[model samples]
Target chain A: MNQLLFFAGLKEAAGTENVNMDLAGLTVEEVKKKVFEVYPSEQLQTSMVAVNEEFAGQEHKIEEGDTIAFLPPVSGG
Target chain B: MNGKQVWVTEEPLSPGEIISRVTRRDAGAINTFIGTVREFTKGKKTLYLHYEAYPAMAEKKLQQIADEIEKQWPGTTTVMAHRTGRLDITDIAVVIAVSTPHRDASYAASRYAIERIKEIVPIWKKEHWEDGEEWIGNQKETKPGVPTKEESR
Candidate 1:
């Protein structure tokens, strides 16, 4: 099982901070699709996905026990 | 070597402390950039601002920015801090300190750090106005490197 984390507005839209999904061997794009199915939102489309604290491209392969995060465009100074 | 060079904290950010971390004996110049909350933005009266972040990832990205600065401008030391939770008007929101052998590199690196934070760090701010509140950059039209709707207005 992989833990999917949400931050910023995505967290508010998802209604939770994180979720566990069985997502081994799936690509980051596929993970996004599966996650949206559970908590559908357009914000997820614009978010940048990260795997294990590093930004991941859509084709990046997911491994078991990986931690995934969805980050919206930042507004920090 | 305090190991607090890049951090996200709920407590108020101290510019003096952040500047001290980057101070080096060989550095002839140090540039500090402090971002503060204001009462008015885009003609709206902001009551306060609430900031949130993916703490672990935010710190990682901040360190990445510092690394990029050090690479781009060799011999430069950089430190950054961002305050989370609620911030009132005139309160410090973020601080970036850069020290280099010369003034030019120090200024450039400090500017680069702040811009990269907005571009890549996993921090977000929600503006509370008298009429309403919204998360900045959360709109579909608001993308990095593009002027946000509020900004364009």
Candidate 2:
């Protein structure tokens, strides 16, 4: 299972903070594709992805038990 | 290296607390920068500020900043703490403290910490003005030759 977390504006936009998916052998991009497929209208294009607390590009591989987090652009001063 | 120290909290951050964390007998100079929620911005009446973070990424980037400082300036200690959730006027939004053997190193490291944190850390702020609240992304006044949002990405 993969654990997905959303924060800030992305969380508000998704209307949920987290989800657990049972995709065992998918890459990070594939998981992102599935998330957008489920929430078709949500904006995933501009969000950033992280795996195991590290910033990751879409091509990174995802394994079972990895924690994935999506982050929107930061605006803080 | 003492390692990177980070605190993400909703309560007000104390300058003394942050100072204590980074202080060491080997370091003579310490520099700190405190970011507060101001009551005015461009003639608008600001009520409060709301801060949010991609907790995992924020912490990671903060550690990267700390590491970079240690690489650039040897024997310096750094600490960065940011408050999440709501903050009232005069409340510290973020605090950065650096200790070094010399004053210049402390200043440079502290400034670098804040600048890099702003540029890379996934922390966002919303200004709750009298009219409405608006998110302020990574937009800021830039120095010439420095990278813009598009350039950085």
Candidate 3:
């Protein structure tokens, strides 16, 4: 199982901080589609994906036990 | 050391404490940038702000920013602190301190730190207004003058 995390407005839209899924072998882009199907948001399109706390591109592969995060446009000072 | 001078805390941020972290005997100048919550934004009266972050990743990113500054301006030390949780109007939200052997480098590096933070840090702020609350930079946000999700609820 892989853990997916959300933050900022994405958290509010997803209604939770994290979710677990069996996502091994899936590409980051595929995982994003699954997420949008579950919790649809336009923000997901612009958000960056991070795997295991490091930035990952859409084609990056996901493995078991990986932790993925969806980050929206940051507004921190 | 990784992340020794970077922090993401729930407690109120203090510029003084952050500045002290970057102080050096060989440094001739120190530049500090303090970010405060404003009472109004885009003509809306803000009640308060709620900040959140992916703590582990945020600290990593902040340290990366500091490393970038050092590479760009050698002989510089940088410290940054960002406060999370609820913040009232005028409350200090973030502080960045950079010290270098010269004033020009200190000023430029300090500015670079803040800009990099906004770009890469895994931190965010939700603005609470009298009429509604919206996560700043949420692309799907309700347009101004329209009823917001919170307002309609």
What proportion of the true contacts does each candidate reproduce?
0.61, 0.49, 0.59
Predict model 3's lDDT versus the native.
0.84
DockQ score for model 3:
0.42
Ranking by lDDT: 1, 3, 2
lDDT of model 1 at position B5:
77
Q: Point to the candidate with the largest DockQ.
A: 1
- In order of DockQ, best first, we have 1, 3, 2
Question: Can you tell me which runs of candidate 1 are displaced by over 4 Å?
Answer: B138-153
- Residue A60 Cα positional deviation in candidate 3, in Å, after optimal superposition: 0.7
TM-score of chain B of each: 0.88, 0.87, 0.86
What is the lDDT for B92 in model 2?
A: 90
- Give lDDT tens digits, candidate 3, residues B56-104: 9999989888888889999999999999999999999999999999999
What is candidate 2's lDDT per residue for B23-100, written digit by digit as tens? 899999999999888888888988998898876567777878888899999998888888889888988999998999
- For the predicted complex of model 2, DockQ is 0.33
Model 2 docking grade: acceptable
The pairs that clash in candidate 3 are none
Q: Show pairs that collide, candidate 2.
A: A75-B136, A75-B137
Off by over 4 Å in 3: B1-3, B138-153
Query: In model 3, what lDDT does residue B68 have?
Result: 86
